[model samples]
Target: MQRSDLLYGLIDLFESFWQMAVPLSAQGEPTDDAGPDPTQETRQLLTYLSGGLTDGAIARELGVSERTVARRITRLQEVLGARTRFQLGIQATRHGWI
Candidate 1:
């Protein structure tokens, strides 16, 4: 399969696992405190990164500079206590954040 197709499949699998692992409330919100509203951007960045997007691509998609993306990712890592992108992805998966 193509890379995009593979990515989509992985995303679908992750979504399914997430739904099974952490059901949403009747109001359609996650039960846990993933973080504050200001961290929404960090969550988006993590999602994009998990989907295999590069910092340059994420910067373009988010309409921000690559430097800003890097900085935000660093801050996200700090907040999540993730030592690496792989760890961030794992933490996100475990916390049902994606």
Candidate 2:
């Protein structure tokens, strides 16, 4: 595999292990999405993701757990019908989400 792809896989593997080590009941910081505007956390996550940061790195930057970063990514993927992070970044840029 390409080095980039291998690094991505390794990041995901480490994130999975981190999540498993943490409590399943641990909750992420609450976000306010009541308005039409995107929450700051969401925007930050997108920015980090667009910059090609791994979930762990993004989580550290956002002061949240990797699981929380993964959850936000899943939500964004569903909202944008994006099958991958690259697609999500493209769609976000198209819609000016980031």
Candidate 3:
């Protein structure tokens, strides 16, 4: 399949998994804010995640310290209600925030 097809398929799979795994209201609520208006930094962070980079790699790319990267990632996790990096990716993809 094409890369686009694969990407969409993966998104679909994640959406389905979330729909089945989480309650309707619980699935919609993110811990940080109600709306999904991510900042430029957050967007860049998501782009880095899409590239499958580690926090260290992302910090290097953004010219920041790993501690800063970790802080941002922690905030992102709360904002997206994702317990892990993998779940963050899936949730971000599903919400069209990535």
TM-score of each: 0.58, 0.61, 0.62
Candidate 2 ranges with C-alpha deviation above 4 Å: 1-35
Q: Model 2 over residues 3-97: C-alpha lDDT tens digits? A: 79888999999998766341212243222222355677888889998788999999999999999999989988777656678867766665557
Off by over 4 Å in 1: 1-39
> Taking the tens digit of each residue's C-alpha lDDT, what string does model 1 give over 64-89?
99999999888766655566788667
For candidate 2, give the lDDT.
0.72
Q: Sort all candidates by lDDT, best to worst.
A: 3, 1, 2
Candidate 1: residue 18 Cα off by (Å): 28
- Runs of candidate 3 exceeding 4 Å displacement: 1-33
Q: Report, for every candidate in turn, its global Cα lDDT versus the true structure.
A: 0.74, 0.72, 0.75
Superior candidate under lDDT, 1 versus 3: 3
lDDT tens digits, residue span 1-98, model 3: 44798889999999988765522345544434436578887888989988989879999999999999988888877777677787777777656677
RMSD of 1: 11.9
Clashing pairs in 1: none
lDDT score for residue 35 of model 1 = 73
**What TM-score does prediction 2 earn?**
0.61
CA lDDT, candidate 2, residue 71: 93
Q: On a 0 to 1 TM-score scale, where does candidate 3 land against the true structure?
A: 0.62
